[model samples]
Target: MAEIDPDAKRRPASVKELKAMSHPLRVRIIRLCGDHELTNKQLADRLGVDPGTVYYHVRQLVDAGFLEPAEVRTGESGALEKPYRSTGRSWWLSVQLEDLDTSQGFAPVEAFQQELAEAGPASIASYARFALHLSPEDVAELDRRIVAVIDEYVETDTERAHLPAHGGIFLLHRTPD
Candidate 1:
């Protein structure tokens, strides 16, 4: 088993950053940039939006440290274009669950919807759902284990070059009896 990267740091995102990412478009933009670098114009074209809108969102993401400047290249119009890429770090936020239920709550679902629309339902290879009861300690341990597994895959650098972009989400919560 590989150990966690010593240099890898997981810091809680600031409120400003979280607010910036609360928008579904921003979430989709981050997901789109996950595997490869892209310019605002490319992202705009992919989402069928204007370059100005993409530029605004890209600037917000870049300012939040979720995206970084990748390169500058000439576009089809022979003008220089700036590209950006995801930082490849999962954000850690300590907000109360109630807070997330606000505007940020549906962002992930929207992002998933956008991806499904792009890839089509036929592209999905696997899907599963489960519900289980456990003690508080067990719940904590289970969460840790699941996160470790996800982190292992998330940190894959070399192999990711050949792999396509994928998204996975795990939601755990206890319901009142």
Candidate 2:
């Protein structure tokens, strides 16, 4: 497997691309495509949504350069099908959610929640809950360190593709006191 260069700069997502990624469905679409090529119909089936709705989201991802058309292949029914694959562009793009409209900024978190619900508690491999008291700089440091560790795993992921796919999210939010 190829190693990643840690110092390489990540591309910043453009306003258009950011807008395209603002919806929870679109975020989920990106995650699904990242795992494997899927046609609009297949995505609709997996997402439990109408094909028409998935088609719109797929078109948006395609336009934003997050998803690309893969080679046409014969389906199980021996019918020709066109599928889309994640371009992996989102992994290399820096998206500053704070700069986006507040209502649109939580797409990834919302998508994660939906996916977790679908996966159910039985699918959880591990869980943790904690409370921390930290200054702004400490919080930033904690986030940076945790992200670096996750990034290392992400960079080396293809080496372990044969393993089962697992999903996770990390969040640190202020307590409502």
Candidate 3:
């Protein structure tokens, strides 16, 4: 949840994709896609939302190219459901850091970035709940290194899956920052 590295040569998320993710349900979909490819039912159940709503968001993410159809599975109704995988663990907005007014382009990307920064505590707390076995010092160093990687690999190329998905390691040093 640290500030994204501005000079990391990261590719920025497009306005359309950022807008698609601004929706709360769609954000959950992206998180769900972090692991295994999931059908709408699984996502809806996990998110505590209606299947119809989940279906709509999944379609939107797919259309925006944030989610990809990894497989197809049939339900009890014999309806074919498309299981989706998240294209990336996270996204970085590329709007100018000093741009106060976003009247033209990438406003949604900027907005999402601001929203995430404001919710930093929640991110930190949630990240803390994950299980990781290691000594204190080693864990701290691991956190620093993983964050550097995630922060550095901010470039997101929708044209190709250059970054590995479903693989992330977070470490918290517990030292004052």
Backbone clash pairs for candidate 3 read: 11-155, 143-171
Tens-digit lDDT track for model 1 on 1-177? 864532244555567777777888998888788766899988999989999999999999888888899878888899998899988543443334455656787787787788788888888878877778899899867766776677677656557667665676677777777
TM-score of 2: 0.91
Q: Against the correct fold, how does model 1 do in TM-score?
A: 0.82
lDDT of 3 at 29: 73
Error of 1 at 159 (Å): 2.4
Better of 1 and 2 by TM-score: 2
Model 1's alpha-carbon lDDT is 0.76
Give the per-residue Cα lDDT of candidate 2 at 170: 86
The TM-score values for the models, in the order shown, are: 0.82, 0.91, 0.51
Which sections of candidate 1 miss by over 4 Å?
2-9, 91-101, 173-177
Better of 1 and 3 by lDDT: 1
Q: Which of candidates 2 and 3 reaches a greater TM-score?
A: 2
Off by over 4 Å in 3: 1-9, 74-79, 89-177
In terms of TM-score, how similar is model 3 to the real structure? 0.51
Ranking of models by lDDT: 2, 1, 3
Ranking by TM-score: 2, 1, 3
Residues 66-97 of candidate 3: C-alpha lDDT, one tens digit per residue: 88898688867999877889887345444333
